[model samples]
Target: DTAVSQTPKYLVTQMGNDKSIKCEQNLGHDTMYWYKQDSKKFLKIMFSYNNKELIINETVPNRFSPKSPDKAHLNLHINSLELGDSAVYFCASSHLQTQSPSSNYGYTFGSGTRLTVV
Candidate 1:
């Protein structure tokens, strides 16, 4: 079973349209994050949720919004999507416990949703 999964693996839409990407994690993690990877493969953190509380919201455009109904789900909604918004959106989850050599501090990432705005 996939620890993290995202729906609509590929999305294609027009420039003025709106779109959403759904994500879910079954790892029972306390924190989730949304990251955008541009054409150059630079990953940027867009938003982060810790136990349903908003934290680490980056300087993304206001057109992008993240909603989390619970600790296991985090959805990204974009309004008036633009060509620049085309990228791979990734959903990741991790436990926020104290760091230790045996502890899993790395994030569990989804396959990624590739959005294309034409």
Candidate 2:
């Protein structure tokens, strides 16, 4: 079974439109997050959710939002899409645990959704 999955592996659209990406995990993880990879392949956290509780990155724009209906899922919604938003969006999850390599708990990222705003 897949640990994590995301929809719309690729998205291409014009600017000024609103779009959303869906994510779900079956690993029974409590924490889920949305990460963005820019053209330079630099990854940055955008939002994190645990049981519907939202923790957003300070550098994330207000136009980006994450919604989690349950602990198993977290989705991202972007409003007024801009060209700068063009990047690969990844959804990931990790079980809640202390910082320890023996925990067997680490982030499992989805294949990613590539969004292109022209």
Candidate 3:
């Protein structure tokens, strides 16, 4: 089973349009995050939810909102989308962090949703 999944793998819309993307995870993790990958492939965290509470990234515009109905699900809504909003969005899940030289900083990420604003 996929640890994390996101819908509408590809999206193309005109500027000023509104759209939404949905995400879910079955890993039973309490923490989930949204990341945006710009054209240059710079990844930045947009939002995070821990046990259904929102932790917004202050740098993110108010046009973007994240909602978590429960620990296993998180969804994003964007309003007044701009041309600069074109990018790939990814959803990821992680639980406990164990620091060991051999242990991978554990995280499972979903296939990204590519959004293009024209």
Candidate 4:
């Protein structure tokens, strides 16, 4: 079974539209995250949900929101989308534990949803 999964792997929308992407993980992890990959392939985490608590990156715009209905899911919602928002969004999950060489619990990322705004 897939450890992590996302729906609607591709999205094409017009400016000023609203959209949402759903993500679910079966790794039994306590922490899940949303990362945005720009056209340059630069990855930057936007929001993180730890055990259903939302922790958003300060740099992220208020228009973007992360909703964790449960520990195994983190869904992203974008309102009044803009062209600048066009990018590949990735959903990832990781064990909620201290990281060490012997206890490394790395992140498992979804296939990614490529969003385009015209």
Candidate 5:
């Protein structure tokens, strides 16, 4: 069984369009994150939500939003998609240790969603 999963494995849209990627984790993790991997394969953290609360909001554009309806779900919404937004978006979940914030367990990543904006 897949620990983490994302819908619309491949998305192709035109510029100025809007898209949303749905993610879910069955591992019962409290923390979930959204990462974007560019064509060069450089992964950048876009957002992180812990227990339905926004925790880490990287320097991503305001057009990009992360919404967590519950501890097991984290979704990414992109507004006015641009060509530069073409990349693979990965959804990952990890068990965050409150006692030691840095001591987080390994993350389980979903099969990335490849977004192509023309």
Candidate 6:
């Protein structure tokens, strides 16, 4: 079983289409998040969910949406995708209650789902 997993390691689509990426974590962590790595390799938080509470970063677009069916999974669904939406999407998780050292506080990311829109 993987600690964190995301499906469709690579995705190529046309602009204005809609698609989704699924994520799951078996680490029993209470906190989970989605991050986007742009072409420039800049990592930015898109959404964070902890104990059923959703914390969204300010920079995310309305076209991007995140949903958590339960504590074990978080999925990303995009509507009217744009060329700019093409990027590497990563799913990660960490222990919420047990705070780890700075080193341990690092995210355990999925292999990454690469999205390319033409």
Candidate No. with top lDDT: 4
Off by over 4 Å in 2: 97-104
What TM-score fits each model? 0.91, 0.92, 0.90, 0.93, 0.92, 0.90
Worst 10 residues of 2 by lDDT: 97-106
Instruction: Flag regions of model 3 displaced more than 4 Å.
Output: 96-105
lDDT of 6 by residue, 1-118 (tens): 7789999899999999999999999988888999999999999999988875788999898888988888989999999989999899999998763444653566788999999999
Q: For residues 1-118, what per-residue lDDT tens digits would candidate 4 score against the true structure?
A: 9889998899999999999999999988889999999999999999888974677899999999888889999999999999999999999998864646668677899999999999
State, as a TM-score between 0 and 1, how close model 3 is to the true structure.
0.90
Name the runs in model 6 displaced over 4 angstroms: 97-104
Model 5 ranges with Cα > 4 A deviation:
97-103
Using TM-score, give the best candidate's number: 4
lDDT for residue 73 in candidate 2, whole number 0-100: 82
Q: Clashing pairs in model 2?
A: none
Q: Give per-residue lDDT, candidate 1, residue 79.
A: 99
Give the per-residue lDDT digits (tens) of candidate 5, residues 34-98: 99999999999888889646865557999998888888999999999999999999999988756
Instruction: Indicate the worst ten consecutive residues by lDDT in candidate 3.
Output: 96-105
Model 2 agreement with the true structure over 1-118: per-residue lDDT tens digits: 8889999899998999999999999998899999999999999989878864678899999999888888888889999999999999999999875567698576999999999999
Better of 1 and 3 by TM-score: 1
Candidate 1 per-residue lDDT, tens place, 10-92, comes to 99999999899999999999888999999999999998888736765557888998889888999999999999999999999
Better of 3 and 6 by TM-score: 6
